[model samples]
Target: MKKAFVAFILLIFISTSRAAKVTDWLDSYNVLWTSQSKGSYDSMPCGGGDIGLNVWVENNELLFYISRSGSLDENNCLLKSGRIRVKLTPNPFINSGFSQQLNLRKGFVDVNAGNTNIRLWVNVFSPVIHVDINSKEKLSAEVYYENWRYKDRPVRKGEGNANSYKWAIPKGLVTKADVIENSTDKVIFYHKNDAQTVFDVTVAQQGMDSVKSKMYNPIGNLTSGGMLFGDNLKFAGTSSGEYAGTDYKSWCMKSVKPSSSHHVLIALHTQQTESLNQWKQGLADIVKGIKSNDDKKRTQAWWNSFWNKSAIRINEKNKDSEAWKIGRNYQLFRYMLGCNAYGSYPTKFNGGLFTFDPARVDSTLNFTPDFRKWGGGTMTAQNQRLVYFPMLKSGDFDMMTSQFDFYLRILKNAELRSKVYWNHEGGCFTEQIENFGLPNPSEYGWKRPANFDKGLEYNAWLEYQWDTVLEFCNMILETKEYNNEKIDKYVPLIESVLTFFDEHYRMLATQRGRKVLDGDGHLVLYPGSACETYKMAYNSTSTISALTVVLEKMIEYSAADSTKSARWKQMLSTIPPITIREENGKKMIAPAKLWERINNIESPQLYPVFPWRVYGVGKKDLDVAVNTYFSDSDALKFRSHIGWKQDNIFAACLGLTKEAQRLTSLKMKDSELRFPTFWGPGYDWTPDHNWGGSGMIGLQEMLMQTNGEQILLFPAWPAEWNVHFKMHAPKNTTVEAELKDGKVTSLQVYPAERMKDVVIMIKK
Candidate 1:
């Protein structure tokens, strides 16, 4: 018994040592800068709990732009709250000795210069922003709340891209001014939407006016903004200025008395109500709920627990190597996603909440900081799916709620679309849809022919693109498979989306021919599209794969109920086999059985290898998928590491080590901007989230891939690129392993029985 006790104590010491090594590895990736920023382009991201701020020190002033989730305006544009500028009488930031760092583990930004030190952090549990400053000598401080929308401003020719109107702006459309009030100790501001918003116009444009009252309108009577208050500060006066070609007004405040320490707080509130007094009360309540002494400790604790969940570290001893950069950037992007974990809505794919001034992204636009290319409330399912899929492997199951709930809240609006237009029984979600679940008015076409179908968007790139929503349905079911999460709330949503394809396609078949199914008793998938690329197609492989996989999972999930399982089994049978053709005398998956025109640069032929998981390392027909990757003409021409592209993902899934390494390296390469992960305006906007998301997915796939009961490790990972990773899998399992010198150095599997199922693919 004495010997056994000694052995147990030794094991505990060894485990604790190993855990410390992992945490130290993460600390090395923290971003540090020795010089001040030139502009917002060089800013560092800092935020939590659905709030995002771009922090920078320029021209002896510390500045940050505040942005919050669910702050949609009358035009359905997601607006920035305001900007805050901080200056000190003795201006320590003007000195040559300066440093700014993003502390990833504690989730805050730290800046130091001369004798002053500043720390900025947002509460992870509440909507509050905190700034703390300490100096050896007592110093006065000036705080400025800047607003660019102080007057009704006309959204110029191309500026409409920032809102729902796009290029089809209605006559006399302008961004309304925000109301600001200044008192001795605080300045309160907010933007309240007009009674009529884009939601109303979209409903009438889509011919759903009769059922408008029953629809859900997220922008109607909405108000969003916050108050600026501090411990020893009082309002000074007002001033006006211009920044980056835009005009603005400022409400100024000054320190009541110089002190060695200063603390400032900005409490933000957003609500949808017709009473302005009610909105003011909500803002006051946020300020009243502050527990300053406890909030910082709690926020830091949340970040610590978050980093402990999962991590991927590569070539830790060599920070200069490309392998190390990819791993570091992966964690940095994940930090950005974590900032919006509990958002009322899912993070936007175009830029999320980290976008900066438009002039910084494109010098020609010269628009406000609120300017992003794609409309604010527009949710493109194809791009949005890539943003959320990587969360599954990282064991961030709780973050998935924002996305799943976004669809649940809009389910009834989608169903109403089907009933009002086609008198159908399932939801009809378009490719480019609004927050209210209607087709974007511009994409729905202001010049539609009288006889055209009201159920379809007039844009060619978006027509017949209803299959993208199926990916979300699959993500919902995957959460249950990966984490054993309770998904009872989303079952109705999944059933409705699946039912749409089944009944709507059958109805189309009946209208054209006598039988509802093809001669093979399969659903006649005509008038379809393969990801806006293979247009006017028949039996699109993407649609077929989506229907087959979702139905099989749904049938398995509903096995306890005989009636639902039987119905889904019948629907599963009607999904046609994935199309294949002979290319250079080798079998390769086809985009569709037939197609008329190539509309865009996307290779949907590899759909079976990825999200659907029809072909992979542990699955059959591996060579056939490999042939398509190397030999398919369209795939070769379209392969790239640009925004929203998934070729790297395909290579990883097929276990093509050299190809996967080459493509993912380009995808993860540092951005041209000062911040390495502020990726691109490629095919979207700066800090393209889908670009980072695709990179995240590829790196995860290279490390591990799961096929039902089997988990394959290092399937596509390079043998010599030493790595330490912790990743989640199906059946509530986690695998933590270390690889060095082309061999597995250590392996730990939770729920020991799962150890038997893990197959080490790399050579020992």
Candidate 2:
């Protein structure tokens, strides 16, 4: 009773504090769609834990697409749990003052129309969706299941880009097999993969067919299904057929008990087991577990803590201004990230878990909910890193584990592939990695060039792009710094990843016709690429910088182990220096020492400024870093505060107050969509995770910067901007501050001992 009372009081205190911190901002910025949506394109996103729902009212009925993280199909593709449609007999939503709002504070959607108030919320702890409808008078409700893959569908061209270069590749790619379903109102549908799923296809494509017996196949035989169950409802009818060039299957369940209120719930489950009864039992357990209100309270508690982790609020300079938009969108985007707090896999960079129909996104695409621009199983390291980097400053450490576990799960396979091919003791990760740690089969280049190296990927952009893994390595180390995380679990991964470059490059140096060692007798990185740009380059700055920074940290962390520390120090010494060249009379960080031509658009030069943090706001050589930011032609040409853009990051790191604010304002502004947070497919799909993540990182960096015992406040903030922020830093430190009208009203640094590190940047 005492514990319960304490929890309740803590909840109340948090509630009150949250109200003071963000209620005004959320009220002014919550997404409010006044009219019915045209289609799924304009759906409102809502989710908790791993479950995601895209809710929208269409044609006098409410519809939503249900999806869950880590629910991959046979082809290693992320699958959706079908769509749900609810309609009332009285039709309260037809031309009757419709309003759909995503309540930011409560983390639920409230749809009000006519005399009905419909509340839609998903339980974070349990995989259950809740719908409660209340009306002035008793009314009947009909819930429908819309399944698109009822029958065996052929893998058609342009259906999805998952197969990758279908026109060029002649390999036969089969679509999903027939879905298992029943004709009853208590509808349950599942997709089961046989032994001959895409897992076999990818293994063959990557030339790992010989080692197929040794590979870990998560999709060899997997079952993922959803069940609809609710009291006060009975079987109404069923429909199975095609409509308007689309095939689908559905079952209708109608309210049996006549009451003023109606409650309906759906529980979803997935498993590696193939037994149908076991899968059914899993769903049954979910329903049973969610019946009690315990999970709901726990869910609320989880979200309550998530909202209180770290936050930022901007004083509204003017209506719809950039500053106001940045602040509001930061919270909105963070809400989206929080929805999948317990995802099995990391939230994807393209669409994360909130993707609607492809046909809805673009009529030309006309694909299923499972379809995304990149392959479903493919986790592009370049884009994927951006999605997780911001979690450090935001103090979303638990969320970072999903990504860490993803790499850890596949680490053994990565190391095995390297050993099998090169007889090495390291893990080789390409740009496009399958969920199970192999190059994406489709993008591995169907047509092999003459004498092409089998070990290296055939795709030009991904060739020799193993250094991207280091960013995640850095994230792991940084997590330890901020939280005192157990380094034992992640040390192997970091060691093996770094070992690949160390041993592989040295071996390659000996094979080259000419001596490939620099003046210091260090191995020269040749035949490398600078982030899909500067192909066939030597000494790529990004790769070198990654090796140098990660090696130093590894040595520092492993000081107790003399042998490991010595090896790390030696490797660090062997890394070539980051190149600097005079461009138009200004010295700037060069992408590489030598290269043939540009292949892709990415400013790897600024990597030293942000992720590596070799130079930053309070670091040495600030002018050179600042000059690189302004003078780099590639960065200037490709710069935009859109999807995957890092302009805010660079500006903030350089302490460019005005530029940081400007870029971040643009980065966080409402995207041209009904949902403000659905930023773009700007080189990626809708609701870009990288765009939101970069914006979050920029906002946090603008407020505070931590560099080696020094914590600087308002490092890159505009003098006129008034703000309130609390963010995590290294050494288990958190800095909370409020800046109002160019004056520091309050400041608090946790652990009081660390207060000496705080340096308030006051503008006069």
Candidate 3:
């Protein structure tokens, strides 16, 4: 008892020595709004689980856009659940002395105006949103459901860029009018997909009609419904409006609670149901589960643990400085990712679950709220990885399952296509594909003149780019290193992904008069790509690096079975070596062998520096990696701290401390939105998650890095900056460090024995 008690005391001492409360810093940066803004762009975002709300005060009325993840309609378009507007008997927001804030610690928004104050929160464990209003005196309130899609709206070819498949989809794919209804005192609305959905159209176009029955379809008979209920509220019929070229309708409810406080609950549910009655029942059940006080406690408990997981803070002493903004924005961006923690689909890279009106983002687009840059039907793997890769270092492992399972669910369909197309046995995932592992219907270029490669993409940027899944396979392996829970389930996935490269490349080699076993027995990767750049190349660095790293991990995990282990070991040796070339008398990593054209700005050669980590600070090939970053012409031209940016990552990997700090600060700086995390339209859309993801990864690597069993503290951190951070590393270890004024004031490592592996980079 004495020994155990002493150990516990020592643990607390070690933790407190280095780490302060994460919430202490978070509290200081909470978003506060004192005045009303012009449009939805000025709104503050709040959400929990899979539901997100854009809350703002405009035209003396409180309004919010309700969006739930994976709410697809008949067109395979992700749609907004709807909008809600609230009005007080006497509007306080119109007067001087009104304030709104997003409380980061509690994961909710608070608005105070005149005599009334409203607290809005989405339940973290249940699909329900709450609006609790309290006033100094008794007040009457009117809540209304505002829906712009009250009638079928034709999806045009050129709407806001977020409509990923709109142009490719057939014209006249109209969004059916939302079916609005009132049951007793409740006002509800839902959008149900038609019997023939975009999924059916895509399969028929792709010549997969024979096997369409076996494909996993998420659109048929799909419905998304929302219900609003409160004891004080009574249904007050409906109203219509035509404003700003938009025709819309609203269901009104008037309420006057006896007391000063009014509580209203809104429950949202999306399902593949047989009928509207089933959806109504599902919503009723959700409300019943969350209407009690106990559920609020459960939701708060989940959020409390979420905020406690891991955090990073940069202290610049000047709150308004760019450095402070970087740190605050990092946390803010992470908050958006957390909003979809329990989503059925992985958060979309274009906007995740928080996209607002399209007209607000781009005035010329003038599309509905559902419009975003990329379509809902397609998940572009290249941009998609940027959204989830940073979760590894942030220790948000639980949140990663949604993405991993996304690919797993589509694995069989991908494999079937490979077998049907090339008589091959491995799954073939393309750069842009539907959720079911088929290439996007419109992007597949089925109308090409003649003799085109049926398996290759007509778009130069996406052709021969099937290896991005390797990054996710590495993510799974890394997750196991941090926690041993999911290994058994992911092992097969890792094996199959690696096997595809081996089997498919061998088949391609035979047609080029190159034997699979010829000249070093390496697999010939002709017609390959170094990212979207270096098209029509052979033996690309990115593909080889992914093959080498993923196979090594697969062999290690599958060692118990000799056959599986040997197959992976052989495949690793058969992957072509990463190319090196001399440019301006400096040796650098080459994009690929026999490179021809450059289509995009991505630096595929430096990929070895990242995702694979074959060359980095402590690794033997550090000089080569550093030279690649400095001398690569294309890399230098494309480098920016914007959406899907990689310069910060390369700098950190090369131990270029000052460069890492400068680039990371730029990448993490305020995204120029009223809400700082809504980053970009840079190569994607507003609130570009890939941009946020790249920044998150860069900041994480600057603070903590792992090479095998050795942990490097502040490996790429600059000397002038003071930082406090706690981040997870491989092998069930966490390193917490505090550096103030160039001194290593405090440091702590979990599982003290791992301290032997610690390499402190900070100078005394």
Candidate 4:
């Protein structure tokens, strides 16, 4: 018994020692700089709890652009809350001893110079921004609330891209000014939405005006912004200036007296209310709820828990290696995702909440800091799916709620589209959908043929692309698979989405002929699309795979009662089999059985190997999927590591080590920006989130994959690249493993019974 006790104590020490090494490895990835930034483009990201700030020190002044999730303006643009500037009287920032560090472990920014230091952080549980300053000598601080929307500004020809208007802005469209109130020690500001927002225009444009009153409008009476106040500070009047080619006004607050230490707080609030006073009360409530004594500790604890959930560190002994960089970037991008863990809306794939000025991204487009190519409030499921899919393996299930809730909130609106248009059942979600669950007006077509279907988008790229929402539905179900979490709230959404495909396709078939099913007793599935790539397709492979997998999982998980399960099984039987054909003497999956034309560069043929998981490392007929990856003309032509590209993912899923390594390295390489992971403007905006997300998925897939109850380890990972990783799998399980010199040094599988399911593919 004594010997057993001694061994147990030794085991505890070894476990603690391994944990410390992991923590130290994570610390090495924290960003650090010894000099001031040139502009916002070179800033570091810092925030939490749905708020993101582009933080930087420039010209001896501390400046940060504040952005919060769901800050939609009258034009349906996701606007920045505002910019805040801080200046200290005896400014230490100008001193030679200057440094700025983003401590990822604590989720805060630390700026130091001479004898003064400043720390910036956002409360993870509250909508509040905090800046704490410490100094050896007494110093006065001046805080400014800057707003470029001080007066109504007309959006230029190209600037309308930031809003829902895209390139089809209505005449005389203008971004209204914000309201600012200055007081003795505080400055409060807000932008209340105009009564007539894009929701009203979109309803009329989509021929839904008759039922507009019943549709959900997220922008109506929406008030967003907050109060900036500090200890021992007094209002110092206002000033006007120009920033990034736009005019702005500032409300200044200066310290009443010099002090050795000071604190500043900016409390933000956003709500759709009938009265402005009610919104103000909400903001006041946030301030009153600020538990100063323990908020910081609690926020720090949250970040700590976040880091401990899941991690991947590669080549820990060599930080500069490309292998190490891939792992570092994976964590960095995950940090950005963590910033909006509790957001009301999902993170945007274009830039999320960290976009800077447009000029910085494209020198020709000199627009405001809020400028992003894609329309704000528009959810592109094709790109947005990439952003949230990686969270499952990383065990960030809580963050997935925002994206799931987004669909739930608008389920009624989406169902309304089907009822009003085709007089049928099921939710009809379009590819480019607005916040209120309707096709984007611009994509719906400003000038359309008189008889064109009002229900379908007229644009070639987005028309008949209703299948992308299936990816999200599958993600919602996977949350239960990975964490065994209750998904009662999402069951109705899943049923509605599946019902749409079944009923709508049947309705279309009945319109074309007498029978709803084809000669083979299956849905015809004509006029369908294979992602935006194969248009006017017959029996699209992507659509079939999505429907088949989701239905099978639904029945397997018993997400529904006996009656619903019976219907799902019947529908599953009707889904057409994924089509495969011989290309150059090699059997390969076809994009579809037939297609009229190709519209984009996406490769949907291999999608079944991925998202749908019909064929993969351990699945049947893997050779056919591998043949498509290598032999298909469109697949080869479209292979790339650019934004939203999934070649790396396909290669990983197929267990192609060399191919996966080459593609994923390119995807995860350091970007041109100072921040290593701020990848792109590839096909969207700078700090391309989907780009990072796809990279994360590729890396995670290379390391681990699951087939039913089996866990495949090092499926496609390079043996030479040492790694320590912890990833979540189905059945509420987690696998943590360490590999060094092409050998497994240690392995731990939660719930010891799962050890039998682990397959070590890497040979020693």
> Residue 256's C-alpha lDDT in candidate 1?
97
Kindly list the per-residue Cα lDDT of model 4 for residues 655-720, writing each as its tens digit.
888899999999999998988888999899988999999999999999999888888888888889
Would you list the clashing residue pairs of candidate 4? none
- Candidate 2 versus the native: TM-score? 0.94
**Over 4 Å off, model 4:** 1-24
Off by over 4 Å in 2: 1-29, 163-172, 177-180, 183-185, 240-245, 316-319, 513-517, 762-764
Give the higher-lDDT candidate: 1 or 4: 4
Q: Candidate 3: which stretches are off by over 4 Å? A: 1-21, 160-164, 242-245, 256-259
- Give the per-residue lDDT of model 3 (tens digit) for 649-675: 888877788889889888787778788
Q: CA lDDT of each candidate?
A: 0.89, 0.79, 0.80, 0.90
Task: Output the number of the lDDT-best candidate.
Answer: 4
Backbone clashes under 3 angstroms, per model: 0, 1, 6, 0
Q: Count clashing pairs, candidate 3.
A: 6
Mark the 10 consecutive residues where model 2 has the least summed lDDT. 1-10
Q: Which residue pairs in candidate 3 collide?
A: 161-373, 162-372, 162-373, 162-374, 164-374, 164-375
Instruction: Note each model's CA RMSD in angstroms.
Output: 4.1, 5.7, 4.0, 3.9
In Å, residue 114's CA in model 1 sits off its true spot by 1.1
- Assess the local accuracy of residue 737 in candidate 3 as a C-alpha lDDT between 0 and 100: 72
TM per candidate comes to: 0.97, 0.94, 0.96, 0.97
